[model samples]
Target: MYISFLFSSFYMKTEYVVLQILVLLYDQDVLTEDAILAWAREKEGADESDKVLLQQSESFIQWLQEAEEDEEEEEE
Candidate 1:
């Protein structure tokens, strides 16, 4: 997964390796949902692309939460 931020005429790219590391951290419970959401919100700006990303992130987070609840119910 490639995540990039555009500022002015320049584009900043986040490396795939860094994303993989973040995934690992999340899997280990080192990164909480609130933390991820906060980070995403903080990065959001007036750019259209940024707004799209924020919306996607919110959707993804909701999906994750619902999946977790389903799993817990199944275990019960």
Candidate 2:
């Protein structure tokens, strides 16, 4: 992923990886909901350090799940 390679140890100061960017990418269709959910839920191919980063986005992941549920219900 671009994030893992684009950022180095020096730039991973918590603030560098804006969790909101995930939402923006989703909104823009640059990233699909399933892909983000897979990354967050299974940490499919994440390295050890990147796994920690995924943990940091836990709340956002919950929000995504809730939002998806809500949208599905609305469509029903």
Candidate 3:
């Protein structure tokens, strides 16, 4: 039980780190959405939960893009 708990905690923390990296890449425009998706899909031990998190990250990127566009338009 202790081992399982430790593994679960480690997995959750790793997932959080992965999500943060994705967001950072998005913010930097270092990777396109397709590239990000491909990279996530290629990650070891990726599962449905990871897919869900990726979706959330994509949505966030989309939101940020739209917000930036809106600001640019407002300034024009």
Candidate 4:
């Protein structure tokens, strides 16, 4: 599966490490909020950029959920 994903997208310079993570999360249905937070905590030490990225990710998740809820309201 990983090899197939690699072959489909040759343009992006995706590291195997990142791709492996995507695969693990997607294939195993492991992308829970708790898991994501734990992973971020383990990897993103006290670096300022990491801090910013974590904040942005959180904001994006919140925005996406809100957007989905709005869409559901419109459909109803």
Candidate 3 TM-score over all chains jointly: 0.48
Candidate number with the higher lDDT (2 or 3):
2
The clash number for model 4 is 0
| Tens digit per residue, CA lDDT, model 1, 1-76 | 1333344213223333445555677789999766865676576665776564455345555656677688889999
lDDT of 3 by residue, 12-45 (tens): 7876776688778877999776675455556435
In order, the Cα lDDT scores of the candidates are 0.60, 0.74, 0.69, 0.57
Ranking by TM-score: 2, 3, 1, 4
Using TM-score, give the best candidate's number: 2
Off by over 4 Å in 4: 1-11, 15-28, 46-76
> How would the candidate models be sorted by lDDT, starting from the highest?
2, 3, 1, 4
Cα lDDT tens digits for candidate 4, 25-51? 745877864456565566567678556
Error of 4 at 7 (Å): 16
Q: Provide the lDDT at 12 for model 3.
A: 78
Residue 19 in candidate 4, Cα distance off native in Å: 6.2
* Candidate 1 local lDDT, residue 30: 99
Per-prediction TM-score to the true structure, in the order listed = 0.42, 0.56, 0.48, 0.29
lDDT of 4 at 1: 97
